[model samples]
Target: MISLQSGELFDTTIKDLLIPADKVAHVQLGNNLEHALLVLTKTGYTAVPVLDPHFTLHGLISSTHILDSILGLERIEFERLETMKVEEVMNTNIPRLNLNDQVMTGLNLVIDHPFVCVENDEAVFEGIFTRRAVLKQLDRRIKNK
Candidate 1:
Protein backbone atom coordinates (compact mmCIF):
# COMPACT_ATOMS: atom_id res chain seq x y z
CA MET A 1 0.00 0.00 0.00
CA ILE A 2 1.14 3.56 -0.63
CA SER A 3 1.29 6.10 2.15
CA LEU A 4 1.50 9.90 2.09
CA GLN A 5 3.30 11.34 5.07
CA SER A 6 1.67 13.95 7.24
CA GLY A 7 1.97 17.50 5.87
CA GLU A 8 3.29 16.12 2.61
CA LEU A 9 0.17 17.11 0.71
CA PHE A 10 0.07 20.55 2.22
CA ASP A 11 3.70 21.21 1.41
CA THR A 12 3.23 20.54 -2.28
CA THR A 13 4.28 23.21 -4.76
CA ILE A 14 3.25 23.92 -8.33
CA LYS A 15 6.51 22.46 -9.59
CA ASP A 16 5.73 19.24 -7.81
CA LEU A 17 2.39 19.02 -9.59
CA LEU A 18 3.10 20.40 -13.05
CA ILE A 19 3.35 18.07 -16.01
CA PRO A 20 6.36 19.21 -18.02
CA ALA A 21 5.47 20.98 -21.26
CA ASP A 22 7.14 18.38 -23.43
CA LYS A 23 5.14 15.64 -21.76
CA VAL A 24 1.85 17.39 -22.41
CA ALA A 25 0.41 17.92 -25.87
CA HIS A 26 1.28 21.27 -27.46
CA VAL A 27 1.42 23.21 -30.71
CA GLN A 28 4.67 24.56 -32.07
CA LEU A 29 5.39 28.24 -32.47
CA GLY A 30 4.87 29.91 -35.86
CA ASN A 31 2.86 26.96 -37.01
CA ASN A 32 0.04 27.60 -39.46
CA LEU A 33 -3.47 27.98 -38.07
CA GLU A 34 -4.55 24.81 -39.86
CA HIS A 35 -1.79 22.83 -38.20
CA ALA A 36 -2.62 24.24 -34.80
CA LEU A 37 -6.26 23.40 -35.31
CA LEU A 38 -5.28 19.89 -36.25
CA VAL A 39 -3.21 19.59 -33.10
CA LEU A 40 -6.10 20.76 -30.95
CA THR A 41 -8.45 18.42 -32.70
CA LYS A 42 -6.16 15.45 -32.20
CA THR A 43 -5.13 16.29 -28.63
CA GLY A 44 -8.68 17.30 -27.58
CA TYR A 45 -7.26 20.12 -25.48
CA THR A 46 -9.27 23.31 -25.56
CA ALA A 47 -6.13 25.39 -25.85
CA VAL A 48 -2.39 25.02 -26.21
CA PRO A 49 0.47 27.38 -25.61
CA VAL A 50 2.71 28.46 -28.46
CA LEU A 51 6.43 28.26 -27.77
CA ASP A 52 9.36 29.76 -29.64
CA PRO A 53 12.54 27.95 -30.70
CA HIS A 54 14.01 28.50 -27.23
CA PHE A 55 10.72 27.40 -25.60
CA THR A 56 9.78 30.86 -24.50
CA LEU A 57 5.99 31.19 -24.36
CA HIS A 58 4.65 33.43 -27.10
CA GLY A 59 0.88 33.10 -26.78
CA LEU A 60 -1.97 30.67 -26.45
CA ILE A 61 -4.35 29.48 -29.16
CA SER A 62 -7.82 28.11 -28.63
CA SER A 63 -10.62 26.73 -30.75
CA THR A 64 -12.80 29.61 -29.70
CA HIS A 65 -10.35 32.09 -31.11
CA ILE A 66 -10.27 30.28 -34.40
CA LEU A 67 -14.01 30.02 -34.52
CA ASP A 68 -14.37 33.68 -33.68
CA SER A 69 -12.12 34.61 -36.53
CA ILE A 70 -14.21 32.58 -38.91
CA LEU A 71 -17.39 34.03 -37.51
CA GLY A 72 -16.16 37.59 -37.92
CA LEU A 73 -15.70 37.08 -41.59
CA GLU A 74 -18.80 37.58 -43.77
CA ARG A 75 -18.13 34.15 -45.18
CA ILE A 76 -16.07 31.32 -43.77
CA GLU A 77 -12.61 31.37 -45.26
CA PHE A 78 -11.44 27.81 -44.90
CA GLU A 79 -8.33 28.47 -46.94
CA ARG A 80 -7.37 31.48 -44.84
CA LEU A 81 -6.62 29.21 -41.91
CA GLU A 82 -4.10 27.42 -44.08
CA THR A 83 -2.12 30.61 -44.62
CA MET A 84 -2.73 32.39 -41.30
CA LYS A 85 -0.05 32.33 -38.62
CA VAL A 86 -0.87 31.16 -35.11
CA GLU A 87 0.82 34.23 -33.67
CA GLU A 88 -1.66 36.42 -35.45
CA VAL A 89 -4.69 34.99 -33.65
CA MET A 90 -3.23 33.62 -30.47
CA ASN A 91 -4.05 35.35 -27.19
CA THR A 92 -1.05 37.15 -25.73
CA ASN A 93 -2.77 37.84 -22.40
CA ILE A 94 -2.10 34.76 -20.30
CA PRO A 95 -1.39 34.08 -16.65
CA ARG A 96 1.94 32.64 -15.49
CA LEU A 97 3.57 31.24 -12.37
CA ASN A 98 7.04 30.44 -11.13
CA LEU A 99 7.67 26.93 -9.82
CA ASN A 100 8.71 28.46 -6.51
CA ASP A 101 5.25 29.89 -6.05
CA GLN A 102 3.16 28.08 -3.46
CA VAL A 103 0.65 25.57 -4.74
CA MET A 104 -2.15 27.74 -3.42
CA THR A 105 -0.91 30.61 -5.57
CA GLY A 106 -0.91 28.41 -8.63
CA LEU A 107 -4.25 26.94 -7.64
CA ASN A 108 -5.89 30.32 -7.39
CA LEU A 109 -4.79 31.26 -10.86
CA VAL A 110 -5.80 27.93 -12.30
CA ILE A 111 -9.18 28.09 -10.64
CA ASP A 112 -9.95 30.99 -12.90
CA HIS A 113 -8.00 29.74 -15.89
CA PRO A 114 -7.56 26.40 -17.56
CA PHE A 115 -3.86 26.25 -16.65
CA VAL A 116 -1.08 28.36 -15.24
CA CYS A 117 1.99 28.77 -17.44
CA VAL A 118 5.14 28.08 -15.47
CA GLU A 119 8.31 30.03 -16.06
CA ASN A 120 11.74 30.65 -14.57
CA ASP A 121 12.89 33.88 -12.94
CA GLU A 122 14.12 35.08 -16.30
CA ALA A 123 10.61 34.46 -17.77
CA VAL A 124 11.59 31.43 -19.80
CA PHE A 125 8.75 28.99 -20.15
CA GLU A 126 9.04 25.74 -18.25
CA GLY A 127 5.70 23.93 -18.07
CA ILE A 128 2.15 24.21 -16.84
CA PHE A 129 0.01 23.42 -13.80
CA THR A 130 -3.32 22.27 -15.12
CA ARG A 131 -6.65 22.39 -13.32
CA ARG A 132 -7.18 18.72 -13.98
CA ALA A 133 -3.90 17.87 -12.24
CA VAL A 134 -4.90 19.78 -9.11
CA LEU A 135 -8.28 18.09 -9.08
CA LYS A 136 -6.59 14.73 -9.37
CA GLN A 137 -4.54 15.46 -6.26
CA LEU A 138 -7.66 16.50 -4.43
CA ASP A 139 -9.35 13.28 -5.48
CA ARG A 140 -6.45 11.20 -4.20
CA ARG A 141 -6.42 12.96 -0.86
CA ILE A 142 -10.15 12.55 -0.46
CA LYS A 143 -9.96 8.88 -1.27
CA ASN A 144 -7.01 8.31 1.04
CA LYS A 145 -8.83 9.76 3.99
Candidate 2:
Protein backbone atom coordinates (compact mmCIF):
# COMPACT_ATOMS: atom_id res chain seq x y z
CA MET A 1 0.00 0.00 0.00
CA ILE A 2 1.06 3.62 -0.59
CA SER A 3 0.99 6.53 1.77
CA LEU A 4 -2.02 8.81 1.49
CA GLN A 5 -0.03 12.03 1.33
CA SER A 6 0.31 13.55 -2.15
CA GLY A 7 3.99 14.12 -1.60
CA GLU A 8 4.44 10.48 -0.71
CA LEU A 9 2.96 9.50 -4.04
CA PHE A 10 5.87 11.16 -5.77
CA ASP A 11 8.27 9.18 -3.60
CA THR A 12 6.90 5.85 -4.76
CA THR A 13 9.33 3.93 -6.92
CA ILE A 14 8.48 1.96 -10.07
CA LYS A 15 9.79 -1.23 -8.44
CA ASP A 16 6.64 -1.43 -6.38
CA LEU A 17 4.45 -1.19 -9.43
CA LEU A 18 6.36 -3.40 -11.84
CA ILE A 19 4.87 -6.31 -13.74
CA PRO A 20 7.74 -8.77 -13.91
CA ALA A 21 8.96 -9.83 -17.34
CA ASP A 22 8.18 -13.50 -16.74
CA LYS A 23 4.49 -12.70 -16.52
CA VAL A 24 4.44 -10.41 -19.52
CA ALA A 25 3.57 -11.75 -22.97
CA HIS A 26 6.32 -11.08 -25.51
CA VAL A 27 7.74 -12.15 -28.86
CA GLN A 28 11.28 -12.86 -30.02
CA LEU A 29 13.12 -10.71 -32.56
CA GLY A 30 13.63 -13.59 -34.98
CA ASN A 31 10.00 -14.62 -34.95
CA ASN A 32 8.06 -14.00 -38.14
CA LEU A 33 5.33 -11.39 -38.23
CA GLU A 34 2.83 -14.25 -38.40
CA HIS A 35 4.05 -15.55 -35.04
CA ALA A 36 4.14 -12.04 -33.60
CA LEU A 37 0.57 -11.44 -34.65
CA LEU A 38 -0.54 -14.68 -33.08
CA VAL A 39 1.10 -13.80 -29.77
CA LEU A 40 -0.43 -10.34 -29.79
CA THR A 41 -3.83 -11.72 -30.62
CA LYS A 42 -3.67 -14.47 -28.01
CA THR A 43 -2.61 -12.04 -25.33
CA GLY A 44 -5.14 -9.40 -26.34
CA TYR A 45 -2.45 -6.70 -26.25
CA THR A 46 -2.01 -4.04 -28.89
CA ALA A 47 1.74 -4.27 -28.49
CA VAL A 48 4.34 -6.38 -26.75
CA PRO A 49 8.04 -6.24 -26.10
CA VAL A 50 10.47 -7.84 -28.53
CA LEU A 51 13.32 -9.64 -26.86
CA ASP A 52 16.29 -11.66 -27.93
CA PRO A 53 17.05 -15.25 -26.83
CA HIS A 54 19.18 -13.75 -24.07
CA PHE A 55 16.09 -11.88 -22.82
CA THR A 56 17.51 -8.49 -23.68
CA LEU A 57 14.98 -5.85 -24.60
CA HIS A 58 15.15 -4.91 -28.25
CA GLY A 59 11.97 -3.10 -29.25
CA LEU A 60 8.20 -3.31 -29.40
CA ILE A 61 5.93 -5.02 -31.93
CA SER A 62 2.35 -4.02 -32.53
CA SER A 63 -0.51 -5.30 -34.67
CA THR A 64 -0.50 -1.99 -36.49
CA HIS A 65 3.15 -2.47 -37.38
CA ILE A 66 2.43 -5.96 -38.65
CA LEU A 67 -0.57 -4.82 -40.67
CA ASP A 68 1.27 -1.89 -42.23
CA SER A 69 4.24 -4.02 -43.17
CA ILE A 70 2.04 -6.49 -45.00
CA LEU A 71 -0.14 -3.95 -46.74
CA GLY A 72 0.22 -4.07 -50.55
CA LEU A 73 -0.51 -1.39 -53.15
CA GLU A 74 -3.90 -2.81 -54.05
CA ARG A 75 -4.80 -5.07 -51.18
CA ILE A 76 -3.57 -6.66 -47.94
CA GLU A 77 -0.61 -8.95 -48.60
CA PHE A 78 -0.95 -11.63 -45.97
CA GLU A 79 1.92 -13.67 -47.36
CA ARG A 80 4.50 -11.18 -46.10
CA LEU A 81 3.60 -12.08 -42.56
CA GLU A 82 5.32 -15.48 -42.91
CA THR A 83 8.50 -14.03 -44.42
CA MET A 84 9.08 -10.80 -42.53
CA LYS A 85 10.62 -10.87 -39.06
CA VAL A 86 9.55 -8.95 -36.01
CA GLU A 87 12.92 -7.17 -35.98
CA GLU A 88 12.19 -5.61 -39.34
CA VAL A 89 9.15 -3.65 -38.20
CA MET A 90 9.34 -3.31 -34.43
CA ASN A 91 9.32 0.22 -33.00
CA THR A 92 12.76 0.73 -31.50
CA ASN A 93 12.21 4.21 -30.16
CA ILE A 94 10.62 3.13 -26.93
CA PRO A 95 10.43 4.81 -23.54
CA ARG A 96 12.25 2.92 -20.79
CA LEU A 97 12.47 3.24 -17.02
CA ASN A 98 14.76 1.94 -14.32
CA LEU A 99 13.41 0.14 -11.31
CA ASN A 100 14.62 2.87 -9.01
CA ASP A 101 12.81 5.62 -10.91
CA GLN A 102 10.02 7.53 -9.19
CA VAL A 103 6.36 7.04 -10.02
CA MET A 104 6.24 10.60 -11.31
CA THR A 105 8.81 9.69 -13.95
CA GLY A 106 6.62 6.80 -15.07
CA LEU A 107 3.55 9.03 -14.93
CA ASN A 108 5.16 11.40 -17.42
CA LEU A 109 6.22 8.68 -19.84
CA VAL A 110 2.96 6.72 -19.68
CA ILE A 111 1.14 9.85 -20.84
CA ASP A 112 2.15 8.82 -24.35
CA HIS A 113 2.51 5.06 -23.88
CA PRO A 114 0.18 2.61 -22.26
CA PHE A 115 3.19 1.00 -20.61
CA VAL A 116 6.89 1.67 -20.43
CA CYS A 117 9.53 -1.06 -20.57
CA VAL A 118 11.91 -1.33 -17.64
CA GLU A 119 15.52 -2.33 -18.14
CA ASN A 120 18.59 -2.72 -16.00
CA ASP A 121 21.95 -0.98 -16.44
CA GLU A 122 22.87 -3.76 -18.91
CA ALA A 123 19.70 -3.10 -20.96
CA VAL A 124 18.34 -6.48 -19.96
CA PHE A 125 14.59 -6.71 -19.74
CA GLU A 126 13.44 -6.36 -16.14
CA GLY A 127 9.70 -5.80 -16.55
CA ILE A 128 7.20 -3.05 -17.25
CA PHE A 129 5.52 -0.19 -15.44
CA THR A 130 2.03 0.43 -16.70
CA ARG A 131 -0.34 3.38 -16.79
CA ARG A 132 -3.02 1.23 -15.19
CA ALA A 133 -0.88 0.51 -12.13
CA VAL A 134 0.01 4.18 -11.68
CA LEU A 135 -3.60 5.23 -11.97
CA LYS A 136 -4.65 2.63 -9.43
CA GLN A 137 -2.17 4.05 -6.95
CA LEU A 138 -3.37 7.59 -7.56
CA ASP A 139 -6.96 6.48 -7.19
CA ARG A 140 -6.14 4.79 -3.93
CA ARG A 141 -4.39 7.88 -2.61
CA ILE A 142 -7.28 10.12 -3.57
CA LYS A 143 -9.82 7.88 -1.92
CA ASN A 144 -7.72 7.64 1.22
CA LYS A 145 -7.45 11.38 1.41
Candidate 3:
Protein backbone atom coordinates (compact mmCIF):
# COMPACT_ATOMS: atom_id res chain seq x y z
CA MET A 1 0.00 0.00 0.00
CA ILE A 2 1.10 3.62 -0.44
CA SER A 3 2.65 5.32 2.55
CA LEU A 4 4.72 8.44 3.31
CA GLN A 5 6.84 9.84 6.08
CA SER A 6 4.75 12.05 8.35
CA GLY A 7 5.91 15.26 6.76
CA GLU A 8 7.19 14.10 3.41
CA LEU A 9 5.74 14.21 -0.15
CA PHE A 10 4.38 17.73 -0.07
CA ASP A 11 6.71 20.69 0.41
CA THR A 12 4.18 23.20 -0.86
CA THR A 13 0.44 23.65 -1.21
CA ILE A 14 -2.01 20.87 -1.98
CA LYS A 15 -2.01 22.76 -5.27
CA ASP A 16 0.96 20.53 -6.13
CA LEU A 17 -1.40 17.58 -6.43
CA LEU A 18 -3.32 19.69 -8.92
CA ILE A 19 0.02 19.44 -10.73
CA PRO A 20 -0.91 18.57 -14.20
CA ALA A 21 -3.96 20.66 -13.24
CA ASP A 22 -6.71 18.52 -14.61
CA LYS A 23 -10.10 20.08 -15.12
CA VAL A 24 -11.88 19.30 -11.85
CA ALA A 25 -15.65 19.16 -11.93
CA HIS A 26 -17.56 21.66 -9.79
CA VAL A 27 -21.21 22.52 -8.92
CA GLN A 28 -22.47 25.99 -8.12
CA LEU A 29 -24.58 26.70 -5.03
CA GLY A 30 -27.70 27.08 -7.10
CA ASN A 31 -26.88 23.95 -9.00
CA ASN A 32 -28.65 20.76 -8.06
CA LEU A 33 -27.46 17.20 -7.49
CA GLU A 34 -28.46 16.36 -11.04
CA HIS A 35 -25.81 18.79 -12.30
CA ALA A 36 -23.27 17.10 -10.06
CA LEU A 37 -24.12 13.73 -11.58
CA LEU A 38 -23.75 15.14 -15.08
CA VAL A 39 -20.35 16.53 -14.20
CA LEU A 40 -19.26 13.28 -12.63
CA THR A 41 -20.46 11.31 -15.60
CA LYS A 42 -18.68 13.61 -18.05
CA THR A 43 -15.46 13.68 -16.04
CA GLY A 44 -15.65 10.07 -14.79
CA TYR A 45 -14.97 11.34 -11.32
CA THR A 46 -16.37 10.04 -8.03
CA ALA A 47 -16.84 13.45 -6.49
CA VAL A 48 -17.16 17.14 -7.37
CA PRO A 49 -16.68 20.34 -5.42
CA VAL A 50 -19.67 22.39 -4.26
CA LEU A 51 -19.57 26.18 -4.34
CA ASP A 52 -21.92 28.52 -2.46
CA PRO A 53 -23.88 31.45 -3.84
CA HIS A 54 -20.79 33.68 -3.59
CA PHE A 55 -18.57 30.91 -4.97
CA THR A 56 -17.32 29.94 -1.52
CA LEU A 57 -16.55 26.37 -0.63
CA HIS A 58 -19.75 24.70 0.54
CA GLY A 59 -19.15 20.98 0.50
CA LEU A 60 -18.92 18.11 -1.94
CA ILE A 61 -21.39 16.02 -3.92
CA SER A 62 -19.97 12.52 -4.21
CA SER A 63 -20.99 9.34 -5.99
CA THR A 64 -21.99 7.90 -2.63
CA HIS A 65 -24.62 10.58 -2.34
CA ILE A 66 -25.91 9.70 -5.76
CA LEU A 67 -26.00 6.03 -4.93
CA ASP A 68 -27.81 6.73 -1.72
CA SER A 69 -30.28 8.92 -3.48
CA ILE A 70 -30.89 6.19 -6.00
CA LEU A 71 -31.36 3.53 -3.32
CA GLY A 72 -33.99 5.70 -1.65
CA LEU A 73 -31.90 5.88 1.53
CA GLU A 74 -31.39 9.63 1.15
CA ARG A 75 -34.19 12.04 1.96
CA ILE A 76 -34.70 13.09 -1.63
CA GLU A 77 -38.15 14.34 -2.56
CA PHE A 78 -38.46 11.51 -5.07
CA GLU A 79 -39.84 13.39 -8.04
CA ARG A 80 -38.06 16.71 -7.54
CA LEU A 81 -35.03 15.58 -5.57
CA GLU A 82 -32.71 16.20 -8.48
CA THR A 83 -33.92 19.75 -8.55
CA MET A 84 -32.77 20.33 -4.96
CA LYS A 85 -29.52 22.23 -4.48
CA VAL A 86 -26.33 20.57 -3.30
CA GLU A 87 -26.50 22.30 0.10
CA GLU A 88 -29.59 20.23 0.78
CA VAL A 89 -27.71 16.95 0.55
CA MET A 90 -23.94 17.42 0.28
CA ASN A 91 -21.92 16.62 3.38
CA THR A 92 -21.32 20.10 4.76
CA ASN A 93 -19.68 18.84 7.97
CA ILE A 94 -16.73 17.55 5.99
CA PRO A 95 -13.20 18.15 7.23
CA ARG A 96 -10.89 20.15 5.00
CA LEU A 97 -7.11 19.80 4.49
CA ASN A 98 -4.70 22.62 3.80
CA LEU A 99 -2.04 22.80 1.09
CA ASN A 100 0.87 22.87 3.55
CA ASP A 101 -0.37 19.80 5.42
CA GLN A 102 1.98 16.79 5.50
CA VAL A 103 1.22 13.78 3.37
CA MET A 104 0.97 11.61 6.45
CA THR A 105 -1.32 14.14 8.06
CA GLY A 106 -3.52 14.14 5.03
CA LEU A 107 -3.42 10.36 4.94
CA ASN A 108 -4.47 10.16 8.56
CA LEU A 109 -7.35 12.49 7.96
CA VAL A 110 -8.54 10.29 5.14
CA ILE A 111 -8.10 7.22 7.26
CA ASP A 112 -10.62 8.71 9.61
CA HIS A 113 -12.74 10.13 6.81
CA PRO A 114 -12.88 8.24 3.54
CA PHE A 115 -12.79 11.49 1.57
CA VAL A 116 -11.17 14.75 2.62
CA CYS A 117 -11.68 18.08 0.95
CA VAL A 118 -8.40 19.81 0.11
CA GLU A 119 -8.67 23.56 0.25
CA ASN A 120 -7.02 26.92 0.96
CA ASP A 121 -7.35 29.09 4.07
CA GLU A 122 -10.26 30.95 2.52
CA ALA A 123 -12.00 27.60 1.98
CA VAL A 124 -11.81 27.70 -1.79
CA PHE A 125 -12.29 24.23 -3.25
CA GLU A 126 -8.85 23.08 -4.36
CA GLY A 127 -9.43 19.36 -4.77
CA ILE A 128 -10.90 16.24 -3.23
CA PHE A 129 -8.44 13.63 -2.03
CA THR A 130 -9.66 10.10 -1.42
CA ARG A 131 -8.22 7.29 0.69
CA ARG A 132 -7.11 5.60 -2.50
CA ALA A 133 -5.01 8.57 -3.56
CA VAL A 134 -3.19 8.58 -0.24
CA LEU A 135 -2.46 4.89 -0.47
CA LYS A 136 -1.25 5.24 -4.06
CA GLN A 137 1.04 8.15 -3.20
CA LEU A 138 2.44 6.24 -0.23
CA ASP A 139 3.09 3.17 -2.36
CA ARG A 140 4.96 5.31 -4.87
CA ARG A 141 7.13 6.74 -2.10
CA ILE A 142 7.90 3.31 -0.68
CA LYS A 143 8.97 1.99 -4.07
CA ASN A 144 11.21 5.00 -4.67
CA LYS A 145 12.81 4.65 -1.24
lDDT of 3 by residue, 23-123 (tens): 45678777766777778888887777787655567877886786576555555555545666666778777787876676656667777776677776776
Give the per-residue lDDT of model 1 (tens digit) for 26-90.
67667888898999999998998888888888778998888776664477878878888888889
Say which candidate scores most in lDDT: 2
Clashes of 2: 0
Best by TM-score: 2
Scored by CA lDDT, what does every candidate get?
A: 0.81, 0.93, 0.66
The lDDT, on a scale of 0 to 1, for candidate 2 is: 0.93
Give me the runs in candidate 3 sitting further than 4 Å from their true place: 1-7, 10-15, 18-22, 53-55, 63-78
TM-score of each: 0.88, 0.95, 0.68
Quote the lDDT for 51 in model 1: 85
- Cand. 1 Cα-lDDT: 0.81
Global lDDT for candidate 3?
0.66
